[model samples]
Each structure stands twice: as C-alpha cells, then as structure tokens.
Target: MRRQKKTILLASPRGFCAGVERAIEIVERALQKFGPPVYVRHEIVHNKFVVNELAKKGAIFVDELDEVPKGATVIFSAHGVSKSIKEQAKIQNMFAIDATCPLVTKVHNEASRHHRKGRHTLLIGHAGHPEVEGTMGQVPEGTMTLIETLSDARNFNPPISDGLAFATQTTLSVDDTSEIISILQHRFPEITGPSGEDICYATTNRQNAVKKLAAKTEYFIIVGADNSSNSKRLVEVALKFGAKNAVLIPDANSLKLNELRNVSVVSISSGASVPDILIDEVLKKLDQEFDISIKIESSIKEDVYFNLPPILRTR
Candidate 1:
C-alpha cells in the first residue's frame, strides 16, 4: 500500500529573524576577524545548532565575563545585558561587541527613560530571562517590577500610583501580553507604555502566522529551542487558537513519529532564533514518512536586516 498523503502548511516569516541573523553573523564575522578562541558572553541566539556551529568556528561561549580573559574580545548575546555586565566588561578592559537585538536595546532604553522621569516600571515578562533581567537592571533596584502573570498585574501596589510605566520582552505571546497589558492599563489608567508594542516585529509576525493556520491545522509543530520564549509562545498560540495539539521541538529528529499518525493537516513554524536548515530537516523527515504537499502560508512579509557591529570592521 502507498504511504498516506499529508498536507503541510509551512509558515512563512518563520525562523532567522533579522536579529538572529545579525547575532549569528556577528559571531562568524568575529571569528573571521580575530581568528580562533574569541569569547562570547552567552549562547549567541539561544539555538543549540547555531551555537554548535559557531563553536566549531572558534567562538567560545561563556556564561559570564569572568570566563573571558582580561582585555580579550567578548560579544554579548542578542538578548542584551545589564548595565552591570557592560560595566564589568569595561572594568576588565575587555573588547566587547554588543550583539543585542536593536529591538531589545529599544526596550532597555524605554525602561531607562521611564526611570529618568521617576515612573516605576512594570516589566511584562518572565523573571530571570536575560532580556527581562537586562531591562529590569536598566533602572535602579526598586524602580522596575516584573509582571509575569495576571495576578502580578493585579496585586502589585506601586510605591505610588501616580508615576507608572510598562515595557515587555521582545519575545512573548502577543495575546497573553495584551491581556496583561490590559489589566495593568485598566488598573492604572495613566500608565505609560511604548509608543508602539514592545514585542518585536518577528515575534508578532510568527505568532500571527500560527494564528492564521491554527483552526485548520490538526497538529502544529513549532521548531525552536525549549528555552526560546517566542518559540514556546508559538506552541501555546497554536493550541489556544484551535489546533488540536501542539508541541515545540528543537530539531527535526526530536519530533516524535507517533504524533503524526492521525494528523492529515499539519502546520510547522520556527522561532525567531531558528535557522532555516532545521526546518528543512523537518520537511525531509516528513517527506520520508508521507507524501506531503506543502504550501507557504505567509501571514506577512519580513524584509528586516540589522548590520554587523562596527568593531567587526575595525582592524
């Protein structure tokens, strides 16, 4: 008997957002310019495959600045970093290159500005996430409070209600963040927010793409790392929007063969940090098991790009 046929809704605007592209390229370029053993402060963009590939090319990923020798080169991850981290690097006289997503840098700046004006900031994201930590640290200790859920949004009594502001991680569930923002805004009518959404363009685009196919898709597979906030949000969005089931797998081979047994229509999307080759492996795996018809369901077109750091150009 012939293998069963399946239809795949391949989400466009998925994988390798401009920031991730820039981050990975920064690593590769740094290696080229400096030769082997250049230090990177963290996993460049949270993708294991990307990290492994870079590691092979002489990028040394360390958890902290101390791991890098004094006055040696180091690159910050795309998630951005705290003022303390930057200051530490400066103190150590390390030649640091910032690979932070400019979008994330924007949030940091916005939160800091709120502090300069004396408004206590409610950072809307999970605590301890590098991005959230960096944003929280932009202002002094008591100036920024993290709001991770509806309860956090509801119960926190600000030092004073008069001055209030909010900023969010670039990677988050759009619907969930909106609800949290609504709760906070409703409670604090005068609260200030970004002139536009803090959630980055790639994140919003990927979530919207998943939403467009969730109802018709029987199963959804989000190709992204477990620690990747935006990728996990894609899984949640698929399940909430109407897909029968959804999961986040880091790679093609990590997908369970059993999960595909009953699904005739599937949707696949990747997080902003994912590389296209991972998605390709998933397609190849799917093709081996079934006669798959793939369609590109692009909710939007993304033409964004971020340039490599200037230090990469310096001798």
Candidate 2:
C-alpha cells in the first residue's frame, strides 16, 4: 500500500509575537536574577505549555495579589491587570513587575487619556478577558462601557454622546472588530477613536497570513490554546475566507488525524502566543503518516520587537 501524499501550507508570522517573547523572557530572567519561587499574577501567557515550562524554572503562577506572600516579587501577566490590582500590590508591599504587552499598555493609556479629556470611553472586546478587564479598569467604573458585539454597539447609549471615545482589546479578530466599530461610529458620528487601531500588528498579520493560506487549502489547523482569543479568531477567519474545514488544536497531540484523512492539502498556522516548536511537532507527525510537501505562505514579514521590562534590564 502506498502512503497518501499531502501538501501542507505553513503560514508565516504565525507564532510567538514579540509581546509573548518578552513576557516569557521576563519570567525566565526574573527567576534567574531573583532565584526560584518568583510569583506571577496569572499564566504569563494563555498557553499552558509556556506556563508549564516556566513553572519548571521556578515561576509560581497565582490568581491574585492576595495569593502571593507579602514582599514576594510578583509579575503581571502579558494580558495586563487592573489599576486596583496595582494598588493592592502596593498596599501589600509586594515587589511588582508589569509584563503587560506594550500594545496592551497602549490601550490602557488610551482609556486613561480619554477619561482625562472628559470623554466617556467605550471598550470593544470580549467580556471577562484579562486585557478587557484591565483596560476597562483604567478609568472610573462608569466612565467606560464594554461593547462585545455589533448589537452592543448599536444599543449602547452613552451618558454623554458628544464626549464618546473608544479603545479595544489587542487580540480581537480584525474583521469582527471592524464591524462593531462601524456600527458604533455610524451611530455616534462625533465619537473619537484611537489614533491607530487598538489591535496589535501581530494579530492582524497572523490573520492576514491565514486568510491567504485558507483560500487554497482543503482544511486548516490552528495550533493554539483554547483560551487564546487570537487563536480562535484564526479558525474563524480561515473558515470565513473559504477553507472547507477549520479546527483549533492546542498542539500536535490534540490533532485528530482522521479529520485530515481525505484532505489532500492542509494549511497550518499557530496563534500569536504559540511557540514554533509546536508547529514543527505537527509537521513531523504528518510526515510520519503521509508523504508531505510543505509550502510557506506569508502575507507579510513582521520585524516588530518589544524590549524586556526595564527592571529585568539591570540583571
């Protein structure tokens, strides 16, 4: 019996965005400089593999500031955290390092700036997401409103419509967010928005790459954690762009080979938070079961880099 032949289209700019790299490096460097048992406020990133690897290196992941012992160095996750969390850390006197992505920080700053200018801010993002929580928390409780869908945007009636502004989550689907934004802007023509889009370049670039690959592939697999917002968006983008089938797999281990049995050409892309090694593992597994030919499909080349947190710089 002959092995089935398959073509794998690999999306570039697919894994480990600069923000994630910095966040992981922050934990590693903190562990090295301060030694083991360093506390991190949340999973440094959404990926369990990355968190587990950091754990082995002596990082302790916790849910809140109260869980951390007094005076212990606690790092914020890449998702950012509330201003109250910072106040609580200060009250507890815990040495704190913020590993929030610079892109996320930008949204926080936008919210704060909008509030200072007396504008009622609207945050466009999924509810309960860490970044959304943090961004919304930047201003007074009632100053910002959360708009997760087009319906929310359409129904939102700001206390003062003339003084409206909006910010967004960095990891949202570009197309979906645009639709929501369009609805809001059409309703409130005077509403102000960020100078540039709130979604980071990494999220936009990865989606673009996947969209190109999805058009030519019979099936698509997105390698990322279930909790990763950007990863879920990739699956939706692929399916929306014409891929016959699309699924999200945390890693190669999660893949159901049967789904690909009839797929002559499959496209693979990883979320911004995923590591390249996971994608390599998936490729290796496919090679063992089928005659595989890999092709690189990239819509753009990303040259973005974010520096490690300043405190880690001295070490």
Candidate 3:
C-alpha cells in the first residue's frame, strides 16, 4: 500500500535551550572532574531520558540535600535553588555546584533587589513549580507573593501598593504573562518589572514559532517531559492559537502515529529540556510510516550561548 502523504512543520528553537545544555553538562563534567555518586538536588532538567542518561553516568538525583552524604559534591538543577539550600549545603560541608540557569538567577537577583529596596515583588508564575518555589524563597517570607493568574493580579491588594515590583519565571507563556502584567500595572501604576523580558529568549522564540504554525497545522506533537513547563505550554499555545488537536508526548517513542493517519499536517516541537534527537525520532517515525514532507518553521535564529560555570570555563 502506498503510504499517505503528510506535511510536517518542524518548529525551530524547540529543544535544549542553553541553560538546559549547561545544566546537563555540569553534571557530566562534575562526574568527570569529581567522579560520581555525584548528587543532584533535582531531575537535572525534567526530562526522563536526560535524567536516566545522567543516572547511568553515575549522577544521583536527590530530592534534598539531606539525601546526600555530607562533604559530597552536589549540583543544583537549572531551575535554581533557594538561598536556604546553599546555606544548608554550607552547613553540611558539602561541595555544591550551582547549575541554575543564569537567566533564572537574574530573576532571583531582581527579586532580591526589590526586597532590599523595600518593594514587594509580585512573582508571576505557577505555584509549586520548583522555579517558583526557588524564586519565592529568594527573599524573606511576605516580601514576595506568587501571582499565577489574572485573577491573582486583579485581586492583589498589597499592604502598600506604591512600593511594588514584579518578576516572572523564566519559562512561561509570553501572552499570558503580558496580560497579568498589564492587569497589575492598571491596578498599581507604580509596579516595576524587569528591564528585559522575564521569560528567557529561547522560550519566547520557541513559543513564537509555534504560534506561527499552530493556525496552519491540524495536528501538533510536542515532544517533551510531563514536568517541563515550557513543553506543556506549547500544547496549550497550539490549541489556543488554532491547532485542532495537540498532545504532549514525553519522547518520540511515545507518539502514536496511528492517530495521525487522518491528519495531513503536523507541527513537531520539543521542550527546552529535550534533545533534538527526540524531535528527529518523531520525524523518522513519521517518515517510516508515511510519505512526509517536512518544513522548518523558524522565525528567529538563536545565536545566544551561555558559558558554563567559572570552574568549567578553563577547560
């Protein structure tokens, strides 16, 4: 039987942002430099495949510092960690390597600066996310509040609204964040924000590319892990923008090509935490099952690069 023809719109800027890359490498290098049984405070980047690969390389992912033996080397996830975590590591005499993405660190710094100047910070992000928790933990309790929705924005009545500022998770929906920001600004004219966008460049670029293809693609497949915020957001963006059906598959191996038989066009993308090999796998699978025509849908070329931590810089 002749295979059916399908169009594949591949989204660029879709996989392994610099931060994730650096984080994963930090573990690898730490293993090489310090040797494993190296402790990681969290799944390095929320991708099962990545985590498993690292685990195979002797990286031990732990939920907290207590799980680690004192004086052992520990690497923080790219999502960043609370100041308290660092303090705890110090008290434990552990050799800690901070793998927090520099962009996330920027948000932490902004939040801390706001608190220092006595400006209450309205943190725009989902609660319970590691990044949100870490950001919230940046300052003393009550110095910052989590604003997860427009409702949160409208309902927020700070003890004193005049001295206020805002910051956001590095991974978030740009449109959604903007709406929240606009609402907060309307309610509190004095609310300040980051000089640049709080959402990282890779996230914004990936989302923008997906937005362009969503209206045209009938079936959208985002290859990413379940816990990845940016990956899940892509699914939401696709459905919101116009894709008829969208799904988040942890990896290409999890995809169901049978369901795509009736679909003529598919947009394939992955989370920043994912590797492009996963996206390639989806393309390979589709190619084997159908006559697929693939088009690269890219609005921006990402030239940005984040250097690894100072110790890793020499080599």
lDDT of 2 by residue, 97-141 (tens): 999999999889989999999999989999988888889889989
Per model, state how many residue pairs clash.
0, 0, 0
lDDT of 3 by residue, 1-315 (tens): 999999999988689888998999899999998887899999989899899999999999999899999899999999999999999999999999999999999999999899989998989999889999999999998889899998999998897747999999999999999999989888887788986459999889989989999999899999988889999999999999999999999876788888898999999988899987787788888899999998988888888778898887653
Model 1 spans with C-alpha error above 4 angstroms: 313-315
Per-model TM-score, in order, reads 0.97, 0.98, 0.98
Number of the top candidate by lDDT?
2
Which ranges of candidate 2 are over 4 A from the true structure?
none
| Candidate with better TM-score, 2 vs 3 | 2
lDDT values of the candidates? 0.91, 0.91, 0.90
Which candidate should be chosen as best, given TM-score against the real structure?
A: 2
Candidate 2's displacement at residue 177, Å, is 1.1
Residue range 1-315, candidate 1, lDDT tens digits: 698789999998899899999888888888888887889987888899999999998999999888899989899999999999999999999988899999999999998899999999999999778888888878889998889999999998999758999999999898899999999889998999986559999999999999999999998999999999999999999999999999899998898978898789999999999989999999999999999999999888889988777877564
Model 1 residue 259 lDDT? 82
